[model samples]
Target: MTSLTIPSPGGRLASTVVAMAVRQRAVIGDEVTYVVLDRQWQVVEPVEAYLEYLRQEQYSLNTVRLYAQGLASWWSMLEDGGLDWSRVKVDDLARFKRRLRDRGIDSTVITLRPEQTAASSTVDVGLSSVLGFYRYHAIVTGVPAARQFYEHVMGGTMEARSRYASFLGHLGGGQDRRVIGRRREPKGPPPFLTPQQMKVIKDDAGRLERGTGWCGDLRLRLFWTLLEETGLRLAEALLLRHRDWQPGTGTTAFVEVQPLEDGRRRLRAKNQQHRRVYISDELDDLYGEYLFLLVELGVDVQDDLPVFVNLYRGEFGRPLRPETIYDWIEGFKRRHPLLPSRWTPHWFRHTHATALLLAGVPEHVVQRRLGHRDIHTLMTTYAHVTEDAAMRAAADWKALVARWGATA
Candidate 1:
């Protein structure tokens, strides 16, 4: 990766004028952790402390990366305004939100639409991260300003009642405190690919030719099929091992989604939860074909080895990096103008869940299949679809009432 060096402006806070950056480090036992760095490349003690707290609390690496970025942005804002972090107030946070809306961290980023500002979702995430940092400090170090950022209320109070509901309803009618609220983003339907688009991409990846077997990269074909059929995350699919797949002749096969200690990279399934995802017979056959091709290429068929490896690249037996898959997707986007411009592998997952729900599958079953920790998450994510279903039911009721009135 190319590094950009910015000349520090002449100021008392020059040591952090370039703001702060998150740096990754390997701790004891080879576990990777992140820390924030100042312009002088020194570790920011307070930020590191917060990140270490998250690590101890078993937050995933992805979560840590996000929190680290938010803290870094906060640090940069402080540096620009020559304000002390300990003295941050609600007003300062509000100003920071405007700054994010106007220019973001780096305005130099290329975009076709220049009028568009930072997305509300992105701003909300950053705000949440920053607030989380202060909340941590307030509880652990008793920072006065940070403590003042929150106010406690009795559970019976309207404020407390409004804040706690749904899954958190149990906490209502008890002593509760409210933190700073994030910007509310507009809800929309989950983005998914159409069946035709799915077929086009799958064919583009690996198409079987007449008189010949599979013509293109059979491994990628299998990988695409696995993602399309199983709704596995890119990381989960890339981290899959040969033993995870259980194939049977003319019967349904299953793949186990479990965390494993991978030396190539430390990618894990979301929440590191273990679940079995069943695959179609065609997908199982695809897996078998890929395995056969691997053996033909003299690749060892070790059960513990990763199912996807860098076959064409010089690093023959190394596990495929997540970047490799992303690069391939970018290539597909370039070649297929008809495909969604912002298409991603995760689209397959959304499509999978949407298809299931539209087919009259139970919400709880879809929740389990998607490995959602709670039904609420699945419901909230696909609320648009559920709401439409409800409207359809109401329409049916209206039609029945009309028929009864005519009969009467």
Candidate 2:
């Protein structure tokens, strides 16, 4: 038998074993034995083979982890019911699905601590993961796959997608969808900083430059400036490299994002599209300053190297993670009570969009600059800013009307 042990939360070892008999059956068209925690189960070999296929497909680490976790949970539940995976029928899967749905409903009703709420939504995602496992297993084994199971369990219906979206909306202080098909509650405008508050934030970031012996201060300043100027998402900014910047004349600097982690450097943007952003003279100067600071620190200015690194970490040179930037911004907010309470990285994007709109920039230009795949996303998110612009147009219309009446 080949056995592997994984450490559990309470310092206990969970054992997983594959027997020689199972290996022989796996090679043929028969059942295999898998033992976990001293319990034995006869499952079809395809389940194991399907998992290997998923790994080869290059799914995200979290996705792979969740699917494996789901399978383990399903197996444990089946064992509790005195059933093995090979003997489990469609009726059993249906009953398991019901239990999952009930558990999810209960979780939704329970109030979780602020920190725990994010983890709770995994219940729904876990359900989908388990269903996907079964469907893949059946496909690989040539078993009679459950069509209804795939439809309801794996494919989230429109209603289910809307409900999931609402659940997410609640985390952001929006309304939860009611079960009785009532109209969704109206939501207020998203929180954003005013122009004056934004100015204060910029000033606070500028103060970092005055400190002595801060090796990465210049990079930090550039980070903040790029966030404000380009309005890129924090994740997008973190993935940037020196090669992304183009120094030459008429050509614009571009940012390419990828949905898959492996493709981040090679593929196009998140929407599978590419965008070109004009680098202002100020941004060019900041980039130069960053390069100079890198030279001062005795670091090579390689095109493949990350644009920013943790200055505090000694010469090993670890690239800064996206969450670290958020933590720094939160720390800055705590230090400066005068700054707006609602300030966030997204607020900088909001402020940029608003400032451009107020300055009479066209909607299409703003859309391109923000790298929005859909113009509707730009319109919906910044609708209030557009409304304010609409009011200004109305005021101009009133003036024209009064002037024409007077001339008549």
Candidate 3:
């Protein structure tokens, strides 16, 4: 039996190799072999320490797989330097951070495209995951100095965390060092159709009615109408079921959204709150036509059946994905070729809110309709739309003063 001594927080300690076996078991005939060690100067084989961490933490299988791969890569980097656990130091960890930057691993963007380098956020997250593995090993093995090394090397403190984050920012051409507190720039306003332009779009969508049967045309018509009238999120509109509709007079009606896979009825809403929207008269008519069309298609007008179905048959026929609405909007853009590139489905929600605010609806009411939890959200996001109203009020006040002076 060969004995290996590693430095621990307590002091230098000796471990003996007990047995050798491969870390992973082969699915088919045989498993890989690797040596395992015991605490005494005797060799003993034990299960991989990282797997124990996953089991103890109750990590999901996917998470375990990711962590295992990341740890393996980190261990390989350490081995390339001929450094074992006891030999690892803060400077070594710093070098690893640089290597990650060199490899272009980014955490911010889910998928990287050509010419897209890893963003600072992305690198930090990946490094953090790798750091977690070392931290876990230190705790489990009862290595005395291991914990201190990890803290100085990878602890989530302002200084330790900043070293890696700053390196990432430098890589990305920025000066930001703090990782968690940084705020992303606010997205520009949602592009919306003006009242006149919406009339044009609706009319264009209506034109599709002539070629397609009434049943097919109803889907596009109602989809557009709901977007224009309700300010519902695209997913919310697509997830609507028959039971969600209420046809009573002067009463509020709404569609309930359930979680769906893909963009089609996917549960990825802004805040995960179930929104109940009042159907506008125009939307009600569209919904009526949709119901009639559903009956004609021999599709039961029951709650279980998807309210919206794919016009073309394929896997997509499950229900309309949010992208489908955007695709249609894109098609509309192509047909017109005159609309601005910024125009999108979200623009309809913004347009709806802006129009209501311009018509003297209360800011709070607009907030509720838009599912904004705070009134400030409406005021801040749509401040530009209210500027004209403010200007008109100022002009009206001046006119009233002039009239009073003349009368006196």
Compared with the true structure, what per-residue lDDT tens digits does model 3 show for residues 105-222? 4334554453544455445545655555545545566555555665565333323332222222232333323232223345665455665676677777664445664533567777
Alpha-carbon lDDT, every model: 0.70, 0.54, 0.55
Give me candidate 2's TM-score against the actual structure: 0.59
TM-score of each: 0.78, 0.59, 0.54
The local lDDT score (0 to 100) that residue 101 gets in candidate 1 is: 71
Using lDDT as the measure, the top candidate is: 1
Task: Name the regions of candidate 2 deviating beyond 4 angstroms.
Answer: 1-124, 131-145, 152-191, 206-216, 248-269, 337-344, 350-360, 380-385, 388-408
What candidate 1 gets wrong by more than 4 Å, as runs, is 1-30, 104-116, 152-181, 249-251, 260-266, 386-408
Clashing pairs in 1: none
How far in Å is the alpha carbon of 66 misplaced in model 1? 1.8
Return the candidate ranking by TM-score, descending: 1, 2, 3
| Worst-scoring 10-residue span by lDDT in model 1 | 399-408
- Provide the lDDT at 349 for model 1: 86
